[model samples]
Target: MSSFNRFRAAGPSSLMASAHPGGDSPALRAVRTLRDAASQPRMMIAQPFGPQGERPESDPARAFGANKPHPTAGWIPPTALAALINGLRRWIRLRALKIIDEIAERRMIDRTRTLDSSRHVSDHLLEQLPVPVWVEDESGRLVHHNRAFRALFRREAEALIGRSVAELLPETSDSIPVETRLDTGERRLDVIIGRCRLTLPASSPDFRSIAPVGGRIGTITDITERKEIERRLRELATTDDLTGALSRRAFFAAVEQEAERSSRYGSKMSLMMIDLDHFKQVNDRFGHAAGDRALKLAAQAMVEGLRDIDALGRMGGEEFAVLLPQTSLSGAIEVAERLRKSVAAIAIPVDPHPMTVQLTVSIGVAERLDDESDFDRVLSRADAALYRAKDEGRDRVVFDQPRHRDIFPA
Candidate 1:
C-alpha cells in the first residue's frame, strides 16, 4: 500500500507501531544500534548478578519481552478502559444524589424555622394582651387563653388551655342570653354566646364567646363599686353637710314623693317643723362654732329620738323638718314630744373653755288631713304650729291647731 493510504488508515491508532521494515532492513539496523547505545548494566530478574550479560527485568515496557505493538489499533488498554467508564458513571450518580440530598435538607431546615417562628410570635402575642381572653373549640372546650386570663384567675395559661368554659366560670355566666347586650362596668360590653350577647369590640374572636369557633368567648368586670360611687354622688348632691341629713331641696323632693304615696294608698303622714331655742344667743356668746356644734348635737338627739322610717332634714340654719309616714295625729304629737325632750336634754360642747351647754328646741307637729293636703300645705300648717310653740314657750311641743290664733299680731 502507498504511504498516503497507510497514514490515512493509521490516523491516531498507529502512534506506537514497530519501526522494523524487514528482519534485515536498514531501518531495523538503525533501531537496534540506538537500543544498544542506550542499554546499561543492571541486575537480572530473580538473580544476584548477570550470569552472561543478560538484560535487567526492571527495564521500560519489559512486560512482553521483545514484543512490538500492533498498528491500526486503539491506544487505550481494554481492562483500563472498562474501569475508567465504570468510575465515571459512579461519580456522576454520586454527584446527583448529593445534590438531591442537599435540596431535601434545606427544605427541612426551612420548615423547622417557619414552625419555630410561628410558635414564638404566638407566645409573644398571648403574653402582651391586657384583658382576660379565653377561646374554646367547637365542642365548647378551651383551645387557648391569654396571659391576662391566667393572671386574673391566678392560674397558668397551660392550666386553662383545653378546659371547658363551664369549668372556668359559674353556671350564672353560661345562662346569659346570646345577642342580648349587657353592661358590666357601668357601660355595655359586646358579648355573643349561647345565652348572652353584648355590643362591644373584642381583641380576639374568643372574647365574644366562651368559644369563638362554634364554642364561645367570655370576659368579666365588676361594676358594683362604680355604680355605688354614682349613687353616693347623687346622694351627696342633695345632702346637708352639717347634720349629715338631707338638705331642704332633697327634703322637699322626698316629702312630695311621700305625699303622693300617702294620697294613693290612703295612708296618713305627719310633718314637723322644729326650731332651736336661743340659737342666736348661743352663737353670740360662744361664737358660730358653738352654734354649729349645737346644731350637730341637736341633730344627733333627733335622729336618736325618731324611728328609722322617719325622714329628718336640716331646713337651712337652726331649722329642721321631719316626715313621719303612716302616723296619726296622736302618734305625730308623741313623736314631736320625744324629739323636743331629746333636743332639750342634749348637752352641746362649746369653744374657749370647752363648756357643755344644755340646749332646747321648739317643735310643731302637723298631719296630712286628706289627699288634697300637699307638701306645701302641710309645711304651712307645721310652720304655723311651730310659731305657736315658740310663742307658748322656748322649749315645748305644739300640735297643729288652725283654729288657734297667733298670740301676738300678724
Candidate 2:
C-alpha cells in the first residue's frame, strides 16, 4: 500500500480528516504546536502521537483531533508512524539546541561591552578628581592611584603601583583619620587620610577566587594652610601684641580657671597685681615712646623671674597681673620680691647713646582663701594691697592679710 493509504488505515478517523488539505489538517496543527513551543522555549518538547497511534495527542498539540480507531478493515502497523514521529522529534531538538547556543553567545558579548564601558567611566572619573585618591588591595599593596596622588608623592604610576602603603607613607598609621606630613620636592603638605571598604558586583570576574580580594579606597586632603591660620589666631587671642605677655582678657580667664580649681581641690593659688611706679611721669618727661620702651623692658624682666607655670598679662596701661598656680602665700611673696628686684634693674635706653631710665614696680600678692569662691574677691584684696605698697613705697612687694569681721555692732 502507498504511504498515505497505510497511514489512513492505522490512524484514528479524526486524524484522517485532519490529514486532508482542504479542512483543518495534521500538518497545520503540527505547525501551530511548533509556534506555541517556540514561545515557551523552556518547556520540554512533547510527542504529537499517542501510544496506539490512534490520533494526535491533545496536550501540546491540543488543536488536533482526539483518539478514535480508523474504520477500515485492514490495519496498518504503528511501526511506520512511529518512525516518522521520531524523525520529527530529532529535527525539533537540533533546532532548539541551535537557538540556545545563539542566545548564550549574544548575552556574553553584551556583558563584555558593558564591562568595558564601566571601566572607561571609572578611569575618567579618577583622572578628573582634584583631591588625591588611591586604591590598595587586600594586602595593602597599591593597585591604582590618581594623578593628584602621583603629583603629591612625586612619583610615576608605574613606580607607585604594587608598592605597599608603608612604602608610600612611612610615618603614617594605617588607622582611620591618619595625619601625616609629606615633604615632596619643595612643597610641604599636611595630609589627612580617610578610607572606606570596597565592594564589587557579583558578576565581576573576581567574584569566584581562591583568596578573597577587596580594595581600600582613600582620600588625602592637604591642611597646611588651615594649620597655619589656626596657629596665628591662637597667638592673637592669647598674647599681648606689644609686650608679648598674655592679653588682658586671656589673663582674667586664666585667673578665673585657677580660682575655680583652687576652690574645688582646696589647692593653693596666688595672684599678684603690679603697677609701674611713676609710669606717667616717664611718659611726660621722655615721651610715650620711652614709656612704651620702659613697659616692654619691665615685662621682659618680670618674665625672666617667673616660672613656666606662672601667667602674666597686661591688665591696662601700666597695670599687670600674674597668676601663680600651686603656689603658697610665702612662695608668691618670694616670686613678687624677685620680680620687684628684676623690674628695678631694668634700664630703658631712651637715646641710642648713654642716656637710660630706670624703672621699678609695686606688687601686691593675694592668696586664694577658703572663703573666697569668686576671683573678683581675690582681685579686690590684691588691689588694696597694691595701693598700700604704693603708699608705703614704690618698688616693694606687699602680702595681703585677711580682714577680720566684727561680730558685735560697732
Candidate 3:
C-alpha cells in the first residue's frame, strides 16, 4: 500500500483528520497529538497551573483549533470542535461567575439596608434623649450622632459626619470643652465627655476576648451650674457676709501661708490686731443695728486703705486683724496708724433720722521675729500690744518691741 493511503487509513477519526495532503508530515504529527489528548478526557473551562507556575502552550482543547478542517474536502478539524467547546465553556463559566457576583452584591445591599435602618432607629432614640450623645468609628471619625449632639454645635449632621474629634473640638482638649456653635455666639457650657474604651468580642462567649472596635461613644454632661454653685459655696465659707472680709478661718489660713513664705524666704512680714474703742458703749447707747453699721463702715475703711497684698479679717465682734506680707514692723505700724485714722474718719448713720455715730480703733502691730516660725506668736504679741494701746487710751498705733529681734531671718 502507498504511504499516503495507509496513513489516511491509520489517521484519527474524521473530525481531526489533517488537511495537508503531505504524507506523514508535521501536520499529521500534530493531529496525532491532538487525537491522543482528545481520547483521554473531555475539556473543562479552567486555567491549570504547572509546578513552576506557568501555563503550558495549549489547554487540551486548544489543540483542536490548530488543525482546521480541509476546505475542499469539507471535513472539519478536531481543533475547530475543540475551539467551539472551549468558547462555550468560557461563556458559561463567565455567566455563572457574573450570576454569583450579582447574588453576593444583592445580599450585601440588603445587609447594608438593614444596618442603616437599625442605625436610624438608634439615632432617633439618641435624639430624644435629654443629654447629648455621639458615636465615632474605629478611626475616631464622627459616624453617628443624635439631634441633641448636632444641636450642641448648632450644626447639621451632614457637616459633622466623617469629621474627626480634633476637627469637632477645635480646642484639641479632653478637658471640659468650651465648644462653639455654628453661626451663633459662644455658648459656654462645661461639656464633659468622659471617654470609655469601645470594644467588640472577637471570640465566642465560651472563651471571650475583648477587641477594640473603635473610637468612642459617650454622653456629654453640662456641669456649668453645679460648678458655679460650688464656687459660691466656697466663697460663703471663706468670706464674712456682713463685712465683705475674710472670715476668721480664712484670715488665719492666709496668715499662716504668709508666715510660711516669710520664714522660708527670710523675708519680713507683720501682723496687726485692731479693736474699735468704746464699741460696746455705742452699741448699748444706740442699737445692735447701729453697731453692725459701724462695723461694716470700719471694714470698708480698712479694705480701701490697705494694699492688695494685705488681708483684713474680722476676728470677732468689733475686733479685726491684718496680715501684711513682705512688710516689717514699722510698715505694719504705719498701716495700723492709717487704719486708725480711717476709722476715726468714718461716721455711721443708723436707721433713725437723727442718729449718726463716730468711732475709733486702737491698733497694735508686731513683726515676725527671726526665731518665730509660728504665726501664733506674732498674733499673740499684736494682741498684747493692742491691750497696751487700749490701756494708754484708745485711737493709737503701738508696735510690739520684741527683746531679741531679727526682722529678716536667715
TM-score, every prediction:
0.57, 0.59, 0.59
lDDT for model 1: 0.69
lDDT for model 3: 0.72
Angstrom error of the Cα, residue 171, model 1: value is: 11
Q: Please report how far candidate 3 places residue 26 from its true position, in Å.
A: 48
Ranking by lDDT: 3, 2, 1
Backbone clash total for model 3 is: 2
Q: Candidate 2, residues 129-208: lDDT per residue as tens digits?
A: 98877766777687778898888667998899689645765354233332233442222223333332111111112322
For TM-score, candidate 1 versus 3, the one ahead is 3
Clashes of each: 16, 1, 2
Please list the residue runs of candidate 2 whose C-alpha ends up more than 4 Å from where it truly belongs after superposition: 1-130, 137-141, 150-167, 171-216, 352-354, 403-410
- TM match of model 2 to true structure: 0.59
* Residues 205-275 of candidate 1: C-alpha lDDT, one tens digit per residue: 33342245466555544444564687789878888878887889999998999999999999989899999
RMSD to truth, every model: 18.1, 13.3, 16.5
Which regions of candidate 3 are displaced past 4 Å?
1-121, 162-212, 404-410
